[model samples]
Target: MGADRVGSGRGRVGRTGAYAVCGAVLLAGCASMPDSGDLRGVESTARQDTQVRVFAMPPHENASPSEIVQGFLEALTSDDTNYETARKYLTTAAGHTWRPELSTTVLEDAPETNAEPVGSREEGEEFVFSMSGSKVATVDAQQSYVPVTGAYSRPVHLTKNHEDGQWRIDALPQGVVMGKSDFQRNYMSVNKYFFASDAEAGQSPQPAAVADPVYVRRRVEPMTQMVRSVLKGPTKWLGPVVRSSFPTGTALQAEGDALAPDDQNKLTVPLNARAARVGQGRCEEMAAQVLFTLQNLTPAVDEVELRSGGKQLCSLTEGSHADAVAALTSAQEPDYLYFVDGDHRLVRLSAGSGDTKAEPAPGALGEGEKALRTVAVSRDEHTAAGVRLDGKALYVGALVSGGSLGDPVLRSEGKTEENRLTAPSWDVRGDLWVADRDPANPRLLLLEKGAGEPVEVETSGLDGRVRAVRVAADGVRIALVVEKDSRRSLLIGRIERGGKTDGRPTVTVRELRSATPELEEVTAMSWAGDSRLVVVGREEGGVQQMRYVQSDGSAPEEQAPTALPGVEEIAACQDDQTPLVANSEDGIVRLPAGAQWRKVTEGTAPVYPG
Candidate 1:
């Protein structure tokens, strides 16, 4: 950073006459001249001594008239006598009236004069002197003595004439203020000429101008690179077989879309405008995520409804307005709302009631009109993940508050760059736990609030691609599905406190496949209590069963799997131990602990969980 310098316009003038007088007086005795010059030199010596003694006397003393005059002149001319001493001499009204102009004139001409007097005093005292030859011509010459401080210096003049054997002063015929105006015109004119000449010659005698600030431009590229390194580094060095197992093409493209626009700028976009664009993008991304994840479903329109507990909460689709999207992903703490559609748009949503509006559509980019996606609500609702097609990656949106998905709460997105997120679970603190199914680098990602980036926990060592992930009732323990070659396994992991591996924190994983070695792979996992986790999977014979595992990595115990009656897909409640399942052919089912499963709703379409 640079700053401008402030200048105090002030100038100083040196008295050359005073220096000469002091030197001459000091060298008077040392001169070796002829006898004819010696007499004149002696008289000069006496005058010089008298002048020095008179100048040394104080002002208040009752001295002779000549002595008083000499002392006044010395005091005025001495550099030691500052502005304060000069002000004191101007005691009488007339003296005060002339002081400012007299001071200005003396200061301006001091350097040019042979010997400068401080000022003149017109008291009740008189002195008679005779001026001969050139002296008389110099006094009577057509020269103006313009006082620097007075009004007459501009266009004024002063003339002297011998009257009654004394020189008298009077204004010139042009009617100018003699002392002030004349001096001002000359002083100002000189300065103006100097400055104008320097400026026109392009000679910048002053300092340079300050520089401006730099804005952040490339955000998404760096973020994408960071994610790619974190997720793909270790596996890329593995054999080609491992790399081939990973999904490519559309998955990478979709991940790239989700991580777009990654830079942060000091200048802020309008909250309303940002909110609308992000909301629309979020809806589009989420709809794509959900529709793409489905086996064969294709969306005829860009909009969809978000449902909770068998009731329609809000629509996560775009409307007639450009900013209208049905869903948004956001964080609960420090409450940040972000759009999850490919563009990472965000805005802060305030607490209020009624329909929340969106921004207008963006301008056309090319020949085609871009589809604008936004989230809208009939009432308040909590938004979860928005997944796009081809099973590559999705945006995980979680609500942190105790409120149901139908209520407004904090929202956030869990993003994956290359791995496909098959299942996601949220802890009590709102941190997201996601399971990715890339065989070479299968892992669970923990997205914590305030963490600069998501942390990945490798599940490859546990033996399978994760099919489902769930946090225990205590929120610290987690359950995952691992498949080994052709057989599926249930792996229970406790959230480790101080354990770390390879500079990263580690979760303690304990295999629970002893009692259910016949089980192929876990399809879903949920917590039953603070110490127990419920696991669901199908045996080699294709019969699905539910089992329970302890947090300490204990062996598994068989528990009767809650029959969805006719539902095929199931999701556990984040806040409680109950599970909600839906049958593509029948209706929605709710299975609470120790209670027979009950049907929540029966509709033609499948009931989806947010």
Candidate 2:
């Protein structure tokens, strides 16, 4: 620990600079040093305040078992491409057996090491070390980040190497472990775009790109790794609901160097020959997919040029080919925001004009044929569905000037109002979704084209009764507010569909995971963007608040939306320019970006087209 002594391994200048800084920080306090000296340039590897790279230092001669464990932990946080230096401290067998790619366990801070006293009769054993910490979250092999809460403790056994007489880890976990701050510095989350199946694999007149987010190393040729991750297809959790535009077996042309955007801010992607066979239209879509994925990393990328086998296939310009890959949520581009007026009639405010005046929808439902409780507009804005104010029935009608309302499309068998039908939601495919709260036969129903016979969609792995439902614009995911024991939790589920069974298509909601597990109650929620949602909920013993959460149960980069008190229902879309409308104590309120909420009208259940 002498100031003159510097550690060496890999000869990294940053490691040396780090030691110098540590020495300065210490000597500046305890020991008296020259306060003023001739300013001189020193060898430093850090180019900026934030871009400091930490390099791993190998084990010192005859280090203790505790020191070995601590050094290994630090190595996990270093920016080693292949982790070859980190593995140097381990015995050949232990190094060969370790697998750092399986998963990542993030803790609140560096794990503390404690060694048990060696009083055993065994002649050769050195020590048994325990590494423990407060758990924060875990990243799975699929690279999905899931926040967790618990205590983590693990044992590490070390024995003297027969050949080198050095203590090495003989038993340890397979994956890497690091602190949250280190994890943030080492990894980043990015969304890879894919086309939605729309409940059918190959049957759709149109298309929209859905986001599947995954985490990857930040400083280690991330663009190259991301290209491969996209070609590998969606993660297991999201795979069933979405389909990638890239063909199977498609991969980046192998190159040993890092892939980076060029001087003109354009990226040239070389793909395998599989991509060369695609038609012009399909190839452009492929370029769009890559462009979308890289946008999360390098927003300034102006274009993405795709090539295969030394042949130019196609190119996608950010401004010109942006529509080549449409965001599932904002595909239709909502023109009006819908809500129920004080008179219990469906009304809308034109989004383009930023109009505050409310006008009755052209349909009969808007003409007061039936007092409305809640409403959902189709993604196309061509149709509307409404639940009865009494919550007994659901009906669909057009939003045109002469549109007529029809008989109830679905009915709830619930005996009381609280046990009746929930508000309706429309997917991008124009299907209507609602939950029947009948205690005897509680069910989730879907109507094709908003007017077909209602079918009970399966809710697999569900633990509570669904209180409300909102379908994503991709039409393959659904968000539910499930109630159990007087508490409501928000869960995101994948919608799975099968071939027709007795002339009816079979549908199921699978793998319902909590989008807001930290919250004790979720009162209202809506699809705010592709793979993002605006949620109104609260933690245990905490007051209610509104925030944006990823569909995969991760926190979004954007902070909580403007907080409005008494929010009963909240609505948002992928378009940030569009104001967020909500039903609050001030009646119907609209919040433009960076502005306070203004009363739009006296209404409830303000919603944009999903």
lDDT of 2 by residue, 364-446 (tens): 87898999999998877878888899899898998887777878988887889989998888887778899999988889999
Summarize candidate 1's per-residue lDDT along 392-506 as a digit string, tens digits: 5434332333322221121223244334555455543345566666656556676653132457764334655666565542233456665557675655553543455565555
Model 1 TM-score is 0.30
lDDT of 2: 0.74
**How well does model 1 score by local distance difference test?**
0.29
TM-score of each: 0.30, 0.86
Best by TM-score: 2
